[model samples]
Target: MAELYSKARTKWACRRGMLELDILLEPFVDEAYDQLSEQDKLVFQRLLEVEDPDLFAWFMGHEACPYPELDAMVKFVLDRVRA
Candidate 1:
């Protein structure tokens, strides 16, 4: 996956705004995934890949994230990173 990511570097590097943050987050995601369940891993994968308006909502807990697949991960990542 790293090689694929490397090949896609140009595309990812050109991503705008917070999406660029996701590119910086790849390493942390790898470290964190070691402790996650298979189901949660799938959720994490989707959370990293998808761009939804509510994607970061659950992180703040100011609004509820309706996407069942990513809500737990959004919360978990927020708790882990504290931001």
Candidate 2:
């Protein structure tokens, strides 16, 4: 199904090398993406364009991401996980 393929693509993209990143991203992609606004979805994909080390730092709270859109998306994902 087309829907499954879309999810597969998202899953593959979410597979950042770090296990910690994977753990945070995978479930969020599966469970929360569909509920996101179009702007938020774009923000999430933009977040994926970031390097793995940067993602690790941002997602782990070592530092805030420099991009406002990316930071908001990261926060959205983190909030979904915490909730």
Candidate 3:
């Protein structure tokens, strides 16, 4: 079956108030989101539903993830950023 989400849709969702988060999220959404498994796409959608401050905390490494799915996704994004 086809995925429920599109890269276009996810790209829009990745826009954030914090430029740091935007820099991290938008590239990953562009280059890697389509490569993600369906389950990870669901996890990413859940991650976007989280507040910017909370997402910033996790992305900035000031706080850790309470959910493993989110943590893994965060790592995946970060890895791409570093590469």
Q: Which candidate number would show the highest lDDT if scored against the true structure?
A: 3
Please, what are the lDDT tens digits per residue for candidate 3 over residues 1-83? 24446777888888988898899999988888878889888888889999999999999999999999899889888998789
The predicted structure with the larger lDDT, 2 or 3, is 3
- Candidate 2 local lDDT, 1-83, one digit each (tens): 33433656878999988999999999998899888776677677778889999999999999989998898888889999878
| Candidate models: Cα lDDT each | 0.54, 0.84, 0.87
Structural RMSD, model 2: 2.9
* Model 1 clashing-pair count: 0
| Candidate 1, 1-83: lDDT as tens digits | 43333314523432535653454345445456566766675566556565543444445466877786677666677666544
Candidate 1 off by > 4 Å: 1-20, 56-62
Q: Alpha carbon lDDT of residue 46, candidate 3?
A: 85
lDDT of 2: 0.84
Tell me how candidate 1 scores on lDDT. Answer: 0.54
Candidate numbers sorted by TM-score from highest down: 3, 2, 1
How displaced is residue 32 in candidate 3, in Å?
Answer: 0.6
Which pairs in model 2 have colliding backbones?
none
- The candidate scoring highest on TM-score is 3
